[model samples]
Target: MSRYETRLEDYRRRERPSYRVFEGMQELVCSVGQLHNNWLYVNVDQWDQDPVHTPIYYLDEHWLEECAEDGTAATNEQDEYIPLWISDRQVQTWFELATFESVVEVLKAAGKPVTLQMVIVAVKYYDKRDAYLDYDEVKAVTDLWFVLTKVRNHLTE
Candidate 1:
């Protein structure tokens, strides 16, 4: 049997009642149905006959501790207990560039004029970690101040 078939068979034999799966920003309460390459087939909707194949990397741990601490837990449309799946990438983008003052200071030290567009572009560039950040393609603002601080510290050392 192929690797996919082997994994699917193994999943079938497992006695676990439920599995928590994530797809990008959404969390899914599911049961393992099959495993193909880097994806795991999950049955998300009991009424639906088809299962969704999600990337294995998106599998997340349950939120038992978080629920206990907060006294609240996430649930699906069916009111089934589920954990919230917050995207690492989204968190990195959202609150990463909260402070622009520090970034302005770094730019001043580098002899670069502090302009609104320049700061915006710089934030985008740092967020992507890409060699080239096209003006039209900048999707998120990253924490450039954090990166600049690290680079400055390294140079001084």
Candidate 2:
């Protein structure tokens, strides 16, 4: 069987119920553009499906504490850059789950600027781990920030 088929079969056998809810959904769909540069342009609005996605959890360094049981956790200078599309989603999701005040706090907690690129990187490589964020995962986090920002900005204006 092909890699995709194998993965599908393995996924079917897994017992994790949470992952199952978003099973079989496409992660990303690409749109072709006739740009001069060799780059792919993805439209966040063109996602496969719309659902309630959020980043209700914090990126605590404790989750991977076990890996450093014998000593302090190893650190690395692994910087990541998330595509602009995912960043917008993060802002959207944040807008939905919290009020303008709360959203601003979360953004502050996450650090300043709150740029689209930074949000995308958070989703793609949040807390310097969990590289494989599936579509639904991305959607939830994006939705939270996306909605929150709108509300936050409106309140300010």
- Each candidate: RMSD to true structure? 17.9, 18.2
Residue-wise C-alpha lDDT for candidate 1, range 89-109, written one tens digit per residue? 121112111122233334445
| TM-scores of all predicted structures | 0.23, 0.25
Off by over 4 Å in 1: 1-68, 72-103, 111-113, 130-157
Residue 34 C-alpha lDDT in model 2: 10
Per-model tally of clashing residue pairs: 0, 24
**Number of clashes found in candidate 1:** 0
Residue 16 error for model 2, in Å?
40
Q: Estimate, for each residue in 1-157, the C-alpha lDDT of model 2 and write its tens digit.
A: 9999986775566332111111111211011111111211122243213312322211122322443464433432222122322334332121111122222234445343444333443434432363434334444677787899999999999
Off by over 4 Å in 2: 1-123
